[model samples]
Target: MVGSCSVRFPINLEYLHRTHPHVTTYEPEMFPGLHYRMVVPKVTFAIFKSGKVIITGAKNKMDIDNAFNQVYPILKSSIKITEIL
Candidate 1:
């Protein structure tokens, strides 16, 4: 499966839903953040079901990094930046 990453911050899940209609958004208490997974038929290496997206299971630095990278750009462009460190 292709991995993605993101920081803990505010985001408009609805917008993401619109862009990636097939994506599934979910929150798991085991992980300290939100998660989103989507399936694309064109992605040969995708492990998702034919039309299912799994957006959970980030439990380490690498997993977090992967999700952040995939979502940050979308967040940056679509959301307001109040502060940055």
Candidate 2:
């Protein structure tokens, strides 16, 4: 299944990729958004600079919600890191 949502602010893909190299993939030449994969909910998030997130591999609404909830803090924390550096 797939789900989509947007955060209130723009996201910095470079900082996200730099900070989460293990789980995030950003190849501007090949794709526009940053691809973030989570293991627990087993979902892939196509996260854009505009804060739009496309979620894939979720089985239901609950999974989607769970995945989003799990990722929100990670994204927020990355912003703090971006501010620091």
Candidate 3:
């Protein structure tokens, strides 16, 4: 009951910012990526403009799945269901 995972994908910062402003913060001087936290899965995700995602603080894979399920659609209206998980 301990660990985390990382994911890499492509997304636009302007869209992400437009979509989820309340849940993210970005300051290039402090960090290069946008930091986000998911409340349902209790997971933390570091989302970069390059679409590289690092998901941490998940206790199990199910949590990861839940978080992914919750986040995927927010960025994109549809699901591709490829390699990132």
Candidate 4:
């Protein structure tokens, strides 16, 4: 059973938009958050300017945890720490 989880983490959406141009799509007029899809975990999430991430298609805590572990580094490197604060 896979359950989706919503995580509120700080990030710089602008940097992410520029970094992963192909993987992410941002259209503020249509949606508030930027859409991102993870391949290995096969999970989808919405990354907002406010730094709230809504992760979906997670099988369990282990899966979610693993996804986060992998995803966090990407986000961290893409965005500046100060920008998020």
What are the C-alpha RMSDs, in order, of all predicted structures? 10.0, 1.5, 5.7, 3.1
Can you write out model 3's per-residue Cα lDDT over 1-85, one digit (the tens) per residue? 3333344455665456556778877666788777677888888777765566778888898988888778767645312322232
**Local distance difference test scores for all models:** 0.41, 0.89, 0.66, 0.71
Residue 28 accuracy (lDDT) in model 1? 34
Best by lDDT: 2
Relative to the unseen true structure, what is the C-alpha lDDT of residue 73 in candidate 2, on a scale of 0 to 100? 85
| Best candidate (score: TM-score) | 2
Higher-ranked by TM-score: 2 or 3: 2
Judge candidate 4 at residue 24 and give its lDDT. Answer: 84
Model 2 per-residue lDDT tens digits across residues 33-61: 99999998999999988878999999899
List TM-score per model, in order.
Answer: 0.42, 0.89, 0.70, 0.74
Candidate number that wins on TM-score, 2 or 4: 2
Any residue pairs clashing in model 1, and if so which? Answer: 4-66, 4-67, 5-66, 5-67, 5-68, 5-69, 6-67, 6-68
Model 1 lDDT tens row, 1-85: 3443233455554454456555534333343322445232222111111222233445555654555556457655435523321
Cα error of candidate 3 at position 66, Å? 0.8
Which residue pairs overlap in candidate 2's backbone?
none
